[model samples]
Target: MTQISAGERDRADTLASRRDKFILPDGVIYLDGNSLGPVSHTAISRINHAVTHEWAAGLVRSWNSAGWMDLPITLGNRLAPLIGAPADTVIVTDTLTILIAKLLANALALRPDRHVIVTDSDNFHSDFYIADGVAAATRRDITVRRTTRAALAEALDDDVAVVLLTHVDYRTGELLDMADMSALVHAHGALMIWDLAHSTGAVPLHVHEHGADFAAGCGYKYLNGGPGAPAFAYVAPQWLDSLTNFLPGWLGHARPFDFEPTFEKAPGIRALVTSSPSVVGLSALAGALDVFEGISLDVLRRKSLALTDFFITEVEERLPGVFELVTPREHHRRASQVSWRHDEAYGIVQALIARGVIGDFRAPNIARFGFTPLYLSFRDVDVAVSHLVEVMHHREYDDPAFRQKNPVT
Candidate 1:
């Protein structure tokens, strides 16, 4: 492989200066942003202020004074530009699974005549679980199709009500064409609901431009919010009034504080919110988003491609036949991460983590590495590859300690 010096690569990166904004640890090269992003210094400060001043001192009055009630809308507006959705159409609320369940229910309601919900076989497992649970409860049919972009198109038919898919595959980091898929679904008179769990904040998205009917994603991943951070949901303006929310909590009421006997849905996307917003988590996510204030999504995409390209090149040259590249080679068909298939994928991931190079292991035989342009440097990628070489040469992955699986991984 043709080696590119870190200095040369860093000099070309417009996002290099943005690294200081995050609170990453020393002596570690983190390649797991797709799993959970490291917290930013701004997020830490925001949490402190929310807890110490807003919650502790302001008491209940803070609900109005601190704009706590509007946190969901406020953060949604901030996140709109990143996902290419319009104002008032997006809201930060609930976990990804909850939002997915709600969106699927609403989508099915929209197409009551259609009985089938089509999804990829390799899409996130939680998404499949949510769909299966909803189908079982509502007596709907679900078709699990292949993961290829072409296979998805073939699986669509008049019977399909909703085509649910992860924008980027979690294990392989394969990016599906949103615009094309949405158009196909619409042509079949079916709505498209994209799970942006592995795509948002890591890649440039156009939810509205791509004609997505509904979308959902987590804040804890590339958004850099704390663990179990509140997730986001999006509904197109046209469906805001037509779609029905399954879990219509009080906050989603048109007049939530009115204590009315009837449940009146709020106007626009606000009606999708099920319960009270997590003020602390929203505050932290707001701070995390501040880092993207002046940054361009175009620049982020370019840097992400460069980082992954460099890592793939290095791995191929250093460890010839040791691993198989699973992520797509084309930039447009790839997300902000890369993956490899090997028999000892789990042990290899453990060995790398032990060496202070963090990546993740998927079931059976896949090792994944994520690249965040905002905080990662080109040098970090080079060092991570070097550590992998050391681990392989030393046969450290064969150690008995690495064979033991952890609860989380």
Candidate 2:
């Protein structure tokens, strides 16, 4: 009996119909959704409505009439279900870096008696930089620790105020068990703060169920809110009144319209909104999220695993020993993406892009491919592998043009 092709697998996929919602480029197989997701038709229409009707016609009155002032909260409430957060616990505002700094500060403030902030050594670089800056400014020690998933529990201790980690490894697409880690941090009397930058929209996350104290993630990647889309932050209900907002701004003020002399924080997650949110960006995000309204995350997660598994199998069977798989092999420990280590990973990624298969290259030697289930199918994975095979066979990656590194990659 002949084996079913990847294209056939995609044809039978229940989520395959979702690809119609996106506006992917013709002849391009986009595998970099973990970095930046392509814009959708809904987002485009929402932006147009916001611009032509809300902004141009309604003017300042649109802030009230079109619900511009409430976009952040509205979007947050809509996005809450995706992250397993309760209503009003998540606020869509600010960039990922700023949110991380604020969350770290609040975690430390909550545990003032504690002096150490523990984090993974392979955590996203910006997260580490922010941790370093916050630790320096607050006169606290930052402990960067690296451990395998099995040994993560050993890294926590009594002195730790908070344990910050990315739910998924950005480079290797490794998934960390949120519930287990959060439990470990709590056992050590440390608050658990998760950076969901890579996990949000790509995998199933039950932030509240896991008992995470705080969490933050970007909207541009799997959320498909376009570039510089506002990020979301989650503060557990238990810590709402206790955690201080050290970076408080006017919007977060309890009575901003009253123009009070003293700063007073608003209730719940609203208190985390330090500044006015970008209305247009929020509109785009709202539109992007509309695509997920009735979709089940379980189905999405299953398709994601299938997509990555197929890609891994194709690569290993067709191009043996050419690249080393850096991502975890276990289904539960893997995110929606796959990464490989190759000496000319940069050039190989460039060559893939040249063939209209848009994967990306990380620093040094990591080649990353992000499989966004919303718009990606097994057929796309099959085509991507075919191009990769050609690139490897013809030594296309060795081209001098691909060898020159771009500033962005």
Task: Point to the candidate with the largest lDDT.
Answer: 1
Runs off by more than 4 Å, candidate 2: 139-151
| Candidate 1 Cα misplacement greater than 4 A, ranges | 1-3, 139-149
lDDT of 1 by residue, 1-409 (tens): 5567977898888899899998888898999988999988889899999999999999898999999999999899999999999998889999999999999999999988988888888888899888888887776555434345568778888888998989999999999899998998899999999999999998999999999999999998898987999999999989988867788889989899997988988888888887888999899998888888899988999999999999999999999999999999998899999999999999999999999999999998999999999999999998999999999999899999999999978
Task: Count clashing residue pairs per candidate.
Answer: 0, 0
lDDT of 2: 0.89
- Model 1 local distance difference test score: 0.90
Q: Kindly state the number of residue pairs that clash in model 1.
A: 0
- What CA RMSD would candidate 2 show? 1.6
- Position 112, candidate 1: lDDT: 87
- Show the colliding residue pairs in model 1: none
**Which tens-of-lDDT digit does each residue in 164-192 have in candidate 2?**
89999999999998998898889999999
